[model samples]
Target: MLPTYSPYEGGHDAPELRMPTGFSRNVPERRIHSHNDYWRDVPVYTALSHGVLSIEADVWLNPKDDVLYVSHSVAALTRARTFQRLYISQLVDVLERANVHDHETTFFNYVDYYSQENEREPRRLWTSFYEGNMTPIRLLVDLKTRGNETYHAVVRELAPLRERGWLTRWNGTHVVPGPVQVLLTGNGINADVRAQVAPARDRDVFLDAPLLKLDETWLGVDGVKYGWNSSLAPMASASFSSATSWTGRRTIDPATEEAPLAALISSTQSRGFETRLWSSPRWPTHVRDRVWRTLYDLGTDWLDADDIEAAAAF
Candidate 1:
């Protein structure tokens, strides 16, 4: 599910099942800003078991490493928890030995949520994932800051990789089947990304302009469980929604789905964009076919399902 605020509702987010059938979240490495010491060992079991479209992470490139490592927080960077941890599984060797995945998407929301800064020069996380048998997942890289520095750094790292067909643009535009795409999202995008959208689109990676700003009626519970001060005076009506931060802290009450869904639908209709909402599993458990049918009912263009929650429950 495209990181929904808690209090879950209905649609496709079925963490109980995972992927194509069940729903799970696949954000960027930067946001995964938790702890590499621990997360580095185990892969996202839920993503593997359930099959999320993409995974998330907050990447910080060590100015020195030229060697990319994964650490949600800069403080956590160490020899033990390197981003190339993917190679620990020999997925890279096997590939030197082959593959990238289906249309499955992975969103990399960069920039530390708490501390907004790009972590120096880091290797491409996508390249690391590919080395780990990640099957060329469609990756959307959100530039936390230094949109140019981060984007260019990432793209620079991707040149050879893309040439090998291991990576492409995220937005699902790169015509190459099983190609991974890179996209930019995040507050940093507001100031500079607009100009590059056309060029990025040309390269196969699309840029997501500022989304809704979080506020009172707008509401956002993801970060800090009910973030306030949605719209900034300087940037009034941009797409970035501050009131509705997207994280795991809280969720918008399903009763509040109408407006959000309407806005989402509008985004889809206008930009031909796609998003994922983790549907609350309670409804499906209570009525069986509650979620899937809801998507069918709503005419969701695309979604990830599992075990026919809606079909079996209802």
Candidate 2:
């Protein structure tokens, strides 16, 4: 028979153990993008907990201090919600915890063997649940300030992750996947991104290709023809409403809505770009589900979800 300890006794403390490498243990990575993730009560943590592989943050740069604040609008910006504090810092902490090992020698030996055979670096990866999955998670940055200045500020803010070699980068020939991939979007930012990343032999930052223009001749701000490729842009995204007229009724019209969307998805995928449709209908729970189901059926690469719980469940 076991004896119960008294409440006032001094021996009930929990045991201390080394932290595990699986920060997101058992949470399967999903292709859901946490839309406007900063709007959540706890931004990055909530999305990571839900196994969301992609997240979007709207950033406004203050020219005076060169600080980037995360918010949907300038009026809602706050000092405590800077991009560094909310996203970059938190991500760094998570990656550190996820990649660290209590037995360093064993981990290094294993990595070395794997690297020798593959002729490339081996990554433990951010998704700890999957043993050998090296897919990097996506962070979509929507710049709300002047294009060139804000783009530079965003790059500066990424120093922590960049210095740690945790950012996905494009080498002269191909892309080397890291734990996190930063994709730039939003107001008049194409020229700025092209100017900085286009000529570099190795660049960590990437651009989000326009989904609507993937099939057409995409011209940059400098009037140079730019092609959509995995090296330059990994994903193409657009609004759901812009692609379809269906209001999420019981059934979708085949020719007008379904066919066109499928074609777009096919086109984007053919160009080796992951497809994403944002600003999907959220009204009438069933309608949202219908649209999501249709997207999945059409082979859409990533689902833009405002409600992480519901999207995860689906």
Candidate 3:
């Protein structure tokens, strides 16, 4: 039904073109979170190509070697698919190339000076695509093993990015935005993360707030009621099915369903945390589209999507 054209359609050689250092140039950044990003053919590159700013990786700590392996389960993990190799290293490479300039010596000196002064905004990943946009991309690490041990492993593995001043961090009083923001989630992550980062003057790791429990209070180290703030947990998430009763049958009820949903989203956003609802219905394409539209209309910050291309197009 469609005509096909060959590279040398007219019997002439195809022109050669060199790829630019800024490979993602002109790609508009999207709020879509690439769920199970490691499942992609090329992981981070696939999502980045679609302008998906947020990505997630499920990690397990191999106690033997003290390396973090990325996988949905232990059986799926391989030595080649490490957290450092797939994420941290790749990010460092991309950022290094993106921030590269003709005056390397001068640039490094200025960056170092700014780091000492604590007044510099690190050039973010998106700068490679849209130069000068310093907004950090989200990297959600779901710990599938023992929380504290695994969480620490993640921190250690982030050294490459940390050493380069490319990680968003809490500087005792405020949050310093960087090129990459790592949010720790899943088992055993909460207390350990809080204990470590809460006391440090400059800590890079953060916690993912529980969307449903955003209003609840927890006992702090001092035995006082501690509430979650953007500095500690910048984003909150929940299962879509747990949050709503809609099964993609009829339209979402404006009064009962929509109102509370909107209120919850408002509450989360009001506290400076972005809201993301995962585990939404994906089957029945029309239903998925409707729900996505509804969530977007209701002001959900990040769309958790398995299909990065479709979400980016949306």
Candidate 4:
């Protein structure tokens, strides 16, 4: 008879038995936005792990050092924590593994051996990178530095992803969706550069519109009237306070928020742009939960939050 095995006793400790299965990556993407994501314990991975695909990185272009440093403030900037190291390179690695094809094999054969036509042909069809969670991960690059140079610097740094066809780009006439969508936020996009790129069918970066003022034909402060569309600003945002003052007190009065919030959401969505609201009520955990649920009910595209885990769970 086999040795009497005690239920509590560990049998032959096998490696598979000793190590538990890896965590699931199939967690559905939540509308949660990870604000100032670099501050998190592990940057991009932290939010991704929490099923929050929208992550913001406040990048300051250090003119002297010529480095795009990711941080909330200049005082926190460090060379070791640059955006390339933390986000871009890591994304390349993740997508490379996810591609599931031999990079060594040329995708297009210059000369087809099987065909007597001697014409070029696809040696192996290009495979689109499959995001395990099947969510379009968005990277909100908040420009801490204002200038054409700084904007261009951020664009240059995106080459690793851009070259790999992983970045969402605008073709001459329309926008082509990619695995990662990059939105440039903080201080409007350079006007001159926008004008130049506006005609071009394809571009790697996008502008973040001020949703609160999107409907305004006349500028409140500058008194400048301008027409805007989806190509110019594919994503729009506003402060939570702009919509309502329900600061985590009593339940949000539908009477107060229903009309205004509905109009804002509808108008923004009509223009083919997603909407986001930052500076949401955070105090009183219950109020935060209520706000999160309210935003969900409103069908807000991206629910912005500093507490990524909590928001993702919500």
Candidate 5:
């Protein structure tokens, strides 16, 4: 077995190991992004099956075509190295085979470099998700243009899906499972943002409130988003906690942070949400053992391996 992960031994003690998530993303230099069965990588997959609930992927739509592909950058979106076909299929297979895809949310993060104009162009990239019976995967569009039109494009792309009865909400938000998950990410608060790029009719999608910041009305939604790199040390303590406040560095080697991690687990458990480490390269055997120990004790939730795989894979 690979040294990074302690093969899923025995069972657990913490709160039912509820929300385990891992980004399907991977770094190219690591020989992970291009692997055909990328999800099967020893450390990555084992960690996933054992617990991961959510998967993050970066999606870039082709400038010349309506097709949207996964990859950090356009240069990485090559036909030989990556294909939209295999990317979605394999992941669906893995998730379905694992049986988590049914209820678990898949964050199909859109990372297109299109300008605000292009995003609002009313172009929608379509794909067949086997489990939902072509249910359009819930997309989290990160406006790459940084132009005022990021939200415009998000609304536009979701239009067709709305008409087809595929769209559940209009305001770029909807309930995933626990209840009415009203999201604020889709609604561009920027007045500078364009209006031509608005999504379909806008009746069902009641987009509101970013996930990272806790809104007073966040009662029904089961999950929340944390700002990408925001330091969560304040909420790291007990009392004031939410999924959005839990933190650890993506680049910090999971192996080394065992003790502090255990403390974090105990700290966060009192609040409700779990924790996960990301970024730093794989650690050695003994360190990984400690890492898993923390997982057992704390019931940590997600680990972001890298975006290279998630974006490029599908």
Candidate 6:
């Protein structure tokens, strides 16, 4: 049965708070995705300073008051740590001052240069200004409340960024990239509900699909194969623990676990979605470092990490 927020229905008609303009810190971002980002001392800026490409914010909505709070757990929520305050507004503040260079133009020009030079070596593209690198940052919003309702509220609060063309969106034909791609995860919006929202004119937000579901039998499975597409999921991810039983005590044996991990990453990438592995071993001293090294050596697209400094260095 669909859960209803009845008595609290009319209580949440508060006006949306306006936010300040965003600014940019010029730096080259790493592939590290800082998990539980709200727990950081400074939230978004802390990850940004470390050159982390992605940051996560778990949002909880109070049905009675209609406020979205950012917290790792509901018990830790407070009005001061709101989604609008920490993430949405901060994003606006950074993106407002983002380097307005033409990435598409520069990219094509670089490709042409490589082709003209007849260079076989793959080229790396990094925009270097007087200050730092200017790459698009990703914001992963983990929904901790009711899916549909919270999804709608999240969309509503993103109007400022949406108006400025900072949020990623799916037009009817293609996925238009933006400065900040709002990826929805946790208890995501229902599939049927997503379908309804998928075709809207200004649909910029996207879903973070679960990579764990894609296995050898995915193609033959009913309902599993559906709703997985580039427009919906630019990236899909799974927990590292789910893929293997290695706890960092002993070295990971490639003979037993390599094929499956390879298959999962390769399969997901083949489907046009970037892959991420989270919930990896983080302690026991050398174990954490080893696990990070293994993941890096394996060429996973994004590293789900809590230690920003270590990930940045790695």
Q: Which candidate comes out best when scored by lDDT?
A: 2
Task: Count clashing residue pairs per candidate.
Answer: 75, 0, 0, 2, 26, 8
Per-residue accuracy of model 6 over 1-314 as CA lDDT, tens digit each: 33443344353341121111123234556888998787786778888877788989899988987778888787898878888888888777665444333533343455355445544432222221123233457788888886577887788888888887666667667665566788888865455445545445457788787787643222211333345676777888888888776676777778777666777778788888888988787786488888888777777899888888887877
- In model 6, what is the error at residue 190, expressed in angstroms? 4.0
lDDT of 1: 0.36
Which lDDT tens digits does candidate 2 get at residues 101-178? 555425555566556666566754344345555667789999888668888888889999999889999888878888
**Candidate 2 wrong stretches, greater than 4 Å:** 1-19, 103-108, 122-128, 215-224
- For candidate 3, the clash count comes to 0
Per-residue lDDT for 1-314 in model 4, tens only? Answer: 45754344465553333311123235566777888687775777777677777888888888887789888887887778998988898777656554534333334342253234423321211122222233467888888887767777888999998887788788667666666888888843445445444454568787787887665432222334444567867788878888666675666667776667877888789888889989888878888888878877888898889888788767
10 residues in a row with least lDDT, candidate 4: 121-130
lDDT of 5 by residue, 146-203 (tens): 4444443444554443444444343333222211111222223222331221232334
The list of candidate 3 runs beyond 4 A from truth reads: 1-21, 103-128, 219-225
TM-score-best of 1 and 6: 6
Against the true structure, candidate 5 has what lDDT? 0.33
Clashing pairs in 3: none
lDDT of each: 0.36, 0.80, 0.79, 0.70, 0.33, 0.70
All candidates' TM-scores?
Answer: 0.45, 0.88, 0.85, 0.78, 0.36, 0.76
With a 3 Å backbone cut-off (N, CA, C), the pairs that clash in candidate 4 are: 171-201, 172-201
Candidate No. with top TM-score: 2
State which candidate, 3 or 6, has the greater TM-score. Answer: 3
**Total backbone clashes of candidate 4, pairs 3 or more residues apart or in separate chains:** 2
Give the per-residue lDDT digits (tens) of candidate 3, residues 155-192.
Answer: 88899989887888998888888889999888634665
